[model samples]
Target: YLDVDLSLDQVHLYLCEYLRMKDLEGPYNAELVPVVTKAHRSDAVPSLTQHELDAILFEVTEANENPEYPAVAVLFQYDAAVAHNALGVTGKAQWGVLAGYDRERQLARIIDANAKAFGRSWSVTCEWLLQAITGYGYIVMRHVGRLLRRQSVRGSASM
Candidate 1:
């Protein structure tokens, strides 16, 4: 029922703000504790502690279901790690954006099929939610870039 506009940047900002409010730090926070713990506890490259993985899973689940923080799901799902694995970070950002578009189209088809099966209209809000989920990854990165630019400008101005 949220009036979501499917802009990647906006989605990212919403997610960043939501996580900030929740005091969840960011997606990387979950990994940090475990990685550090493993560095000391074992010689193997530190893997996520069960607790860290659980936190990430919980966030992903909440983001997928909650309209208010749709970007969180996207961030966790298509992170830099995934992007790097796919095409390396050289053009990963662009790839992520294009991938989001593809995802949106695919999700739309699925949603449409489900709606038909249930004999319900694919209402505007439902469409919005679908777009939010599918386009979440691109949006989060865009949002982060914008925020960094703003901070840079402010810092320069202050100097």
Candidate 2:
């Protein structure tokens, strides 16, 4: 209906590239992570669970106290409304962010583009949120101070 329909992979890359470009942006660059998928993967896929997400976030938070990529968020792909169970789109592959959580309150906030429930962000019970989300893997966003040179050592040797 619009112009051209894009696959999830394309969408993911677009998002990643967008963030990379945002590195030129002012404040957003200070805390941005680019790329949405593994170079060899086509889709993010459902590979994680709610509990796993919680653990990852907790670790990221703890690390951010003094480490790299201080900010990390989960992008969930599910078949429910971004905000409430009865407020927006459903029965489709909708995406949203698990901005953060409150273990004490047992709540997780969902930030969405089609949000209308809680003014672009919705706070729902973790149980409900987990039940409604799919793993689909999300990129751990961060602020890169400089280019990172990665290394590879294989062939069963330290090299």
Candidate 3:
């Protein structure tokens, strides 16, 4: 239903959300680093102000349970790539390039799992239908109302 033209970058953002959900990473959240808007030389690394750095550190620190060396280090690397525009190319390609694929697999798994769950009761189907309908325009709403009413009549007759 969303008709906006999503660039590869925007698609990456959706992928991030999908990966986080599939990983069951409850506390994990990612925000695009503002550095993406800045013009930078190909060889220059993106820089963050102290506050941005602190916020990122806070997220990772909070995510850590034991704060052991390797765990913190890995967490730091993950967040750092996102916080800087370092997610662009080669030397940092493992973080950025790989995230795209990781997110794709995670999204596919979630879609598959959701499709399986959709084979459920009529209550679920109705709930989903209602939620979707409510997001539409007034003219669409009238059609949805008539459809629901017809469905209700048919449902009662079957009972």
Candidate 4:
């Protein structure tokens, strides 16, 4: 069983397989787009190159049928604030999700799943990402793909 704060790598692996199954069903396919390091994050400034970032943006933006917006999220480790907005765990290296951007305020929008535990402590400067990340790991920018099919098949029969 996965703890609430499951490691991002494990979650990503499960998701990639699930999406691959969906793609094989001949409805929709959301392939892994960005190339990143296979190892766990240890780098201080995990980042996405301009070309990769642009490609993700273009693909997501092109999907006019997307419900809320693009299905992409930026995952990285950080020195999360230990005060009230910690990532629901102490002692563990903090991680956060880059969901959206606020051009006006100039901040990378952070939307952690444990938002309730930490409150809505979102929005950090691009500079914070550059300087605060834990290591020099490559960024894992992912698109949480859509299933053109009906509901999610979540049990033993899902595959």
Candidate 5:
């Protein structure tokens, strides 16, 4: 539903805002990190290193275990060619990248896993749906209102 293409910084800010709205009591909050590789450079074909994977897996485990933070979601952006080598291989200490419908399915699995690990239900939602429709007009405004109401109800019940 989100139409706007946000830069990484903007996404971080929005994530912070959403976390704030959660009103979770903690010493630390959720953090979003963008990992970029220089594979596009002709000089070097950078791939996700084992150390990097270990660090990311550690972060994911920490995020799940830390009482101060709810969760950490790593968004990886990579070229198809680089991903093919970096992800599809077996016996590698790296997590494979899921794309298209598989990405959505894997995301759901992650949410479910987090829910079990944290003893709570987890869900993902995009903020731009409200941002995009609010200024459009009456029909859009009504739709946004409904969406807001639904979200508020769900949030209230969940938290």
Candidate 6:
């Protein structure tokens, strides 16, 4: 059994907020979808394979299920579908006080991981992936950009 310090309601709210910030919503919240058009990124570079997608999903599920934040599992599953449906990157908008990592750090880690995996900056990788998948990457980039903007504002405000 996973033990979380926060109530389930709190986790749910955070999940919704994250989705709102990302502009990803709808039935199943599935951002990933079949694409009939050939994307420039995929044509120029290699396409993202189902195997890669499965691996990423596995990692996210494991992270979400970590006992530190019990509600994270549900939140993750919910957001992932939303992001997938929107063709959004599955790792953005990783907010909340769950699973031991704060929202910002979680976003950063995922961005960094994508950058390392794709040999591009976080934003570039997100764009490439979205283009590869059809259009979901744009949604992820928007949320990540929002987070970056917020951080910048907060930093300037602190001065």
Candidate with the greatest TM-score versus the true structure: 2
Tens-digit per-residue lDDT, 14-93, candidate 5: 54675567653243343333333343344543233333333333344434454353344443222222222234432211
For model 4, give the RMSD to the true fold.
11.2
- The parts of candidate 5 lying over 4 Å away from their true place are 1-4, 25-27, 32-48, 61-71, 77-159
| Candidate 4 residue-wise lDDT, 38-106, digit = tens | 334444233344333333323333343364644444455555553224454555445555565554564
Off by over 4 Å in 1: 1-6, 26-72, 75-159
**TM-score of each prediction:** 0.23, 0.54, 0.26, 0.49, 0.34, 0.24
Q: Compared with the true structure, what per-residue lDDT tens digits does model 1 show for residues 57-130?
A: 33333344544534332232222223223334332212121112222332211122122222222222223332
Off by over 4 Å in 6: 1-37, 41-43, 67-132, 138-159
lDDT of each: 0.30, 0.48, 0.26, 0.45, 0.29, 0.31
How would you encode candidate 2's per-residue C-alpha lDDT over 2-49 as one tens digit per residue?
Answer: 012333455556667776686633322322222233332676543444
Candidate with best lDDT: 2
**Poorest lDDT segment (10 consecutive residues) of candidate 2:** 147-156
lDDT of 5 at 43: 52
Per model, how many backbone clashes are there? Answer: 1, 3, 0, 7, 0, 15
Q: lDDT tens digits, residues 1-159, model 6? A: 112343344544554576677665431132222232354344544333433333333334444454553222212212232322344545433221112222233221222212232333222132333333332221111222122222333323231
**Lowest summed lDDT window (length 10), candidate 1:** 92-101
TM-score ranking, best first: 2, 4, 5, 3, 6, 1
